[model samples]
Target chain A: MSDLFPEEVRTERLRLECESVADADLGERYASMNETAIEDGELAYVPIEPFEHLQEARDFVAQREDRMESGDAGTYVVRPRDGEDGAGYPAGEAELFAVWDERTAFMTFGLRKRFWGRGYSGERAAALLRLAFERLGVELVSVTHLVGNENSRRAIGKYVDRFDGERVGRFRNQHVIDGEPRDVVRYEVSKADYEASGERPDCEFVEERADGGDGA
Target chain B: MHVGVANLDCLWENRRVHTGVSLYRPYWGRGYAGERARALLSVTFDRLDLDVASVAHFEGNENSKRQMEGWVEDFGGREDAYIRNAVPRDDGDAEPWNLRSYSITAADYRDAGGAPEVELDPENVPEPTSEPTDLDRANDGGDGA
Candidate 1:
């Protein structure tokens, strides 16, 4: 297993940092936003139950940190670049997880309702794709959205090559939205497709090491 | 002793299996690959009662591409995924090859009259060679890339 992705990525308006235990407060905030989104029927694909307490958020962050250490997955906290200095809450999350032998990974992201419609989702997703292809050497990245999630579809479409048709599969009631089962739409982008799109995020990656050595 | 071998990697949870086949160079172009694939598909669909069976090959491997096409045309398989530069070549200078994956469902397999029959002759099987070929390593592990 290799730690190929950098610790932090900065776009023009957002900074995507690897989630850590120290970011428990941010995690708590994210959990609250997720709960709101779910309750409002704006999000339906999340499998886990909403967090009831801050402790759950801390535990989630700890588990993510462990997965990052094992090189299996990573979750990034999306925050404003010019936001407050310390203990700032995350506006959203962009995650690349379920890495398969460093060859492929799954992408998922969301923005807080307050941050929606700001074009930040596209920026953050582009940055994550760049990290997946350039840093992790992944050949393909996949994303899925439940049917009727037009916002997610649009956000993910920004990075995908439209020439390749999306694959639709029946989840057989996998997602219960408004008490009805819905199918899922899956989209995949290959490294070649990403390179061909010529859409690169204006971002800087900052590598942070735990051993006090400059990441080379 | 072996003229070739076929493999079925069952993903029981997914109700699918991944198939792979390899033959000695001298045995190539004899339609053995297709026959072995049919037999394996039988095991996957009939014996294992699996829902889907999938296979993949590098883009440049015309033999494999042709065989997969045969299965698709005859057994109603469909192209499932194509990942660019997914299969790294053994030669360091050569570029990584694109991978084309295909899948067939048990319903399709049954509609195609199950699996084709292949004759087996244990008496003519050759002794195993000492040297390990790239295909051997690929078939043994490492995602059969």
Candidate 2:
């Protein structure tokens, strides 16, 4: 793990573990979840298509681990603390990747279909924003979603507004999704703006997983 | 005379283009930057068919601030954001640049009368003559007005 972030971070209702390739269970579950990510248009806005095979997903997990080891970015597996269905089975993934040259970082996350509509995005966003501003000491933290993703548009809008961030603009052709360029809506919160906005959602850094054991 | 270079950089997966200029100190306030910017806007909207054109200037750069503001006002754009520590320093000791950014969409460009009325005809050229040209006079330190 990068020294910038803890092994685990938590919001009020969610626990995000920094993902690693060494965690065989996580790689297996992550790959399985992504295999059907495109079903029912769940990952339509995401740039990559559904993972055709396990190796593709495993390769992705290894890449994320490499990014963390390089000290440039961190990817985490998000799980619910207390839920009846899919409580702790890699409900989603959240990441805070630094744009080191800009002294900034960007947030990205995606949830499984069963995990949607619960405001978990906002929850993880709070933790990630806290990590970006307080832990990483970055100047700005940004989040972007496809222009047509209404769920993300609402979720990100609500939290970013709460954090006193501004809508940078709707940038065109921001991503190439399945060989077609797509637009993205971007929002940003500078450290000064985030601090001036005062506390909103609270987050905590933890030395161990919420389960008090290693490797989900 | 190789006074400067103008740039239109792509951003957002080639959806938008950001304009910039680097002029020699002696050519700083000659309105050349403005002329180049107008041409770039034509390329951005009229020729390239891009959706947006953006410009940014580091904080405390009055010349760039004025220039960027002029484009925003003339092109019916707005100040989009104030980004802090937006660019890292190469010197290792200096601080990153804070930027004031602005943008104009295609619709806004059209509302602002679209591209300026500047035409180019490089294919039609006049052969050089012995008569002194205005550029030659300017090179000789004359006003060339």
Candidate 2 C-alpha error for residue A90, in Å:
1.6
How do all models score by TM-score?
Answer: 0.67, 0.79
Superposed model 2: Cα runs more than 4 Å off: A34-37, A82-84, A178-183, A196-202, A208-216, B10-13, B45-49, B90-93, B105-117, B120-145
Pairs in clash, predicted candidate 1: none
Off by over 4 Å in 1: A1-7, A26-37, A40-43, A46-49, A52-56, A67-74, A80-91, A96-106, A110-119, A130-151, A161-200, A204-216, B88-94, B116-145
Worst 10 residues of 1 chain B by lDDT: B124-133
Most accurate candidate by DockQ: 2
**In DockQ, how does model 1 score against the reference complex?**
0.06
**Docking class for candidate 2:** acceptable
Local accuracy by lDDT, each model: 0.67, 0.76
In model 1, state the lDDT of residue A62. 77
